[model samples]
Target: MKNNLTKLVKKANAGDKQSLELVILEINDLIYNLSLKMLLFPEDAKDATQEILIKVITHLSTFHYQSQFTTWVYRIATNYLITYKGKKSKEFAMPFKEYAVLIDSGQSDTVSYAKNAGELALLEEEVKVSCTQGLLLCLNSSDRLVYILAEILEFSSKEGAAILTITPDNFRKKLSRSRQKIRNFLTNKCGLVNSENPCRCHKKIDFLTHQKVINPNNLRFAQFTKRSIDLVDQIGDLEKAIAIYRATPAIPAPETIMKTIKETILIT
Candidate 1:
């Protein structure tokens, strides 16, 4: 797949319009998913994904095949996300202490917006994904990026370091610190990580819905997910706290993103 992407990139760099479109098609989901995880909002993710795609396309000639095409793409994507100061980034720029207080403050009132079991299940899933993604925001952008690459995306330390232009040992240290921070919070506050914890996804659904933090009519995370992360075979051995992120469904890029990219390319 990397080889094929490299070939497409080469063709696109040589002015093959079809290959350029194909290149966008191949990496759209990847860029969108990473952006969504980093930004924690679909609209913000969409906006950031478009910008990053434009960067990749505009800088196509700079890729000299010294690294894997995907790695190069990741380097570009990660750098953009780390420095991105989007609306949600500012809103969610909080320490773990503040976030933990927010989590603990939720009411346990039972409010059912769902008419049936399936709808109720979806709402619960929405809370789980939203809550976990929110936890990620507690980490600063740099640590958040490290945790996302090392845990959610499962990149090796060396690979992550290379993408971030850091040494492997430095990458590992950041990942360890970030991982422990999240684990500590989840272990104390999240029921999924510890059965003794008071916070449950189902219990928070009512509070979150009433607070307008999550809408059953328009779920941001659960609506796009086809399968839970636990259903995937590769995550069985991962620690539960770390695995919670993997549970986020692989959200695809917006359907019109390709058309928009093509038009933008033509204009530029």
Candidate 2:
């Protein structure tokens, strides 16, 4: 695959549109699938895919064959995912709805213009893509990035760190913290804590953890309830993070993921 990719890259660099499109077509699964799972939103996934492809197209001439072309491409995809999440987080944290509304000129009057099945399919794809957009709304971009890479996508900490331009140790630390916050939020809202009972007192919850670091043997799973709970118990020798969060429920409401995906895939 690498050798074939190298050939494709050589051709793509020489201005062969077919070769360029073919290369992207071949790797689209790797690029888009990873982004989709990571972003948990189809629109953002599409956006990340398009952005990475654009970078690949523009920088084709600069690619040094020192590493597998696939590795270079993965790195490009990772960067775009990270940047996309950053902007998305800003929007999620503080949405600009009125500004956004001004931009939607209106839907095309397809019936009057003579409708086609392809147009309907395109609309359907747009709707499905919206799911990916909202998937990471519960997380901050940093947490979203790590969770996408480390948890949902199952990238090892080392690999996740490489893509995000962070040290593995730092990535792990952030992952733990982020997971803790997300878990706490879920438990509070949905009562989905791994505990045996929901009626457990806030005292017990306070003593439990938000997110535990994955052990060398247990990194395969995202939710490490026991380790995190133990760590919380250790920390709350006086008081814990969970107790504090539970004490004050956060203010509510959200962002739109579909729009992000369209921006991502279409890139205009």
Best by lDDT, which number?
1
lDDT at 167, model 1: 93
User: Where is model 1 more than 4 Å wrong at Cα?
Assistant: 227-234
CA-only RMSD, every prediction? 1.8, 16.3
Q: Tell me model 1's lDDT, rounded to 2 decimals.
A: 0.85
TM-score of 2: 0.49
Scored by lDDT, model 2 comes in at 0.49
In the range 103-155, model 2's lDDT, one tens digit per residue, is: 12232232221146543333322222221233245565677777666655567
| Model 1 alpha-carbon miss at residue 225, Å | 2.6
Error of 1 at 224 (Å): 2.8
List TM-score per model, in order: 0.95, 0.49
Q: What's the lDDT for residue 171 in model 2?
A: 92
